[model samples]
Target: MSAFSKALRTLSAMAIALAIGVAASFTPAHADPNATLDRIKSSGVLKVPVMVGEEPGYVKDPATGNWSGFYMDWANDIAGFLGVKVQPVETTWGNLAADFQANKIDIAFGLNPNPKRGLVVDYLSVPLFTDAWAIVTKKGYEKKTWAELNDPSVRIVVQKGGTMQVVAEAMTPKAQIIPVEDRPLGVMELQANRADVMILAIFDAVQVSKQIDGQIILPKPMLINPATIGVKREDGNEGYENWLTNWINYQRSLGLAQGKLHQTFEKAGIDLSMLPPEFSF
Candidate 1:
């Protein structure tokens, strides 16, 4: 071959190699799982966020590190249906919103879907359970209703960055509101008499009442809250949300939630009658 032709051939080969390298570099690092359902199917595990608390209808285990609760069982059932192992990540309500936003957790249990929350994360269609605000106070000081708790001298302890804070501020503008780090701490504040009352979920209030010498009073009118699952708001995860929504709806339709609630309350040694009549799963 001529020297010019030989040089041309070598340059062409080099250009082809560079083009291949560039194409490979442009390729996606990972395939879109398309939904949480597909991702779990691929990974063989469902990652769910279990909020750490002693709330009766949520997560609590008196026994040796065994994770057991109403939401836990419900999550396990979903995992079973998906043919995936259940993996629970202990989280806090204060951080759950941020965690979901960061995609650190796939699903958040016992979440009450709110319009403001919908902007940050996607919620399942089915509400697993419903709870209401309960005012917990020392025995003789039990307020009959939210209105009674709204007195200017009434000090209310509420968890920081939680629904209770929003609810309390809206209902009791005149009352002194103290923000605690978490639900348990807010209950502790009330126990210590640092606050006149604590506004929390009825289930949680009942659980705390069992542990402390307090009276839990459900107002004549309850601030009803519907609890659902929270999933990450990602295009790739939309399918998963839909799958979860459908699956949860199926469970609800079959009255599985009622059984789950009974089991949870029984395990917690809580009498269902103690809860307000309106509270239902």
Candidate 2:
């Protein structure tokens, strides 16, 4: 072949190679395991666990089977931003931590971030809500700080497997701790005189106090703790942990946290101001 013809053939081959390179470059990136954002986009839903009860910061309407609470609303907002629906997994306080550890739920709402829990789960950057520990006792029982409740003769009832149990065990090592399946049961134990005091989340204690018809009273002195969403450590894929953390911060910025708390308190017929400030998170 002539030199010009040979050059022309080489040019054509190079042009084809350039086209292939451009096409390859335009191809989508490989899937990332930590890509929680992408997974939400593909799956079109965000699964979250929510407790169903009359707790001031959390509630579920029995009539519609719809959940509405401070944490639930925040979770819904996160799902909305992802253009996905929120699938709420009903859970109880006693089993919420276990469910989160077992990967049964994507996030556990209204949880406190502790070093012990950090061993198993990742906590969001912004807390969903918070509640303080309240010492619930018969009217005029008159115990001040957690230290005051540390007497060996004092029997305190706490919700089994709940954060209060952890706090009680840590703070009042000498006191007798009674663990029950639910907070109301703990309240009942207090009412029955089986327990001297009930250590409970302030919101829960407030709700139980109303139900017991002034049988239980929540005093001012209590320990405060902020609660956040708990995600399984195993789910550290696709920046899912970061996405959730950002999502919670976004809600806090929007003032949705405070608004939802007010709404939840109103629905439960409890005064929002009675809640610890951290509960507004």
Candidate 3:
């Protein structure tokens, strides 16, 4: 080889080695991959945040102040594995990232993942399940199809700071999108006839139907989203993320996901007309 060519090759080799050295320095030789796991173990408290306002998936009982729902049960199951007492905290569909940022909670119980949400938190690689969004309205209301709800006169209630807001705006471009702080408040709007409809998951809408006299979640959902547990982005240490991810896999291996879905469905009294097939297996 020419002298110039040999010199260029030498320089490239040095650069590559320097880059590898810098990357190696980022992770100290003695750093622990299970730091988060060890910390939670020592604390003996796993502070889990659940959506107190969203039912059939996560909610706090008004009478007992105890939390129960699909996600709450899942969190309890996780706490069992970690050998820690679950400290259930009340959270809403929105403000998950804010609570995580403030270090007030370790994880959120139930919610779907989106690109916008992905920017703030890290979700498990294996999704817990798929949730399809549908139209919920009064029993006698005539707006059946998604197309019918696309008029400016249609009042669509959406949970603020959640993906439902984006879904409602996109589905009904000309309709009035009324934002509420929580799912129950949105259901209340529909119950009082203050709002024409609210777009939400069948699981949640079913729970709300029991609370309202005449509201019904129609079949034919428009949006399907994958739901999972979320951890703070920066706090997604291998110890924390890996344990949760593997737990999801382990639960599915035991065929618990399907059974859990059915149990919640039974509790919500929601039929399987438009529910996704993945809900079963």
Higher-lDDT candidate of 2 and 3: 3
Q: State the lDDT of candidate 1 residue by residue for 126-175, as single tens digits.
A: 68777777877788875787677778898999888777888889898889
TM-score list, all predictions: 0.80, 0.75, 0.80
Cand. 3 TM to true fold = 0.80
The 0-to-1 C-alpha lDDT of every candidate, in the order given, reads: 0.76, 0.70, 0.76
Cα deviation of 97, candidate 2, in Å: 4.2
Candidate 2 stretches with Cα past 4 Å from truth are: 1-34, 52-54, 213-222, 235-238, 275-281
Of candidate 3, the 10-residue stretch with the lowest lDDT total is: 272-281
RMSD to true structure for each model, in Å: 6.0, 6.8, 6.0
- Residues 171-269, candidate 2, lDDT per residue (tens digit)? 888999999886557767877989988876666666776665543333445456677777776633538777777766776788766667666677878
How does candidate 1 fare on TM-score? Answer: 0.80
True lDDT of residue 208, candidate 2: 72
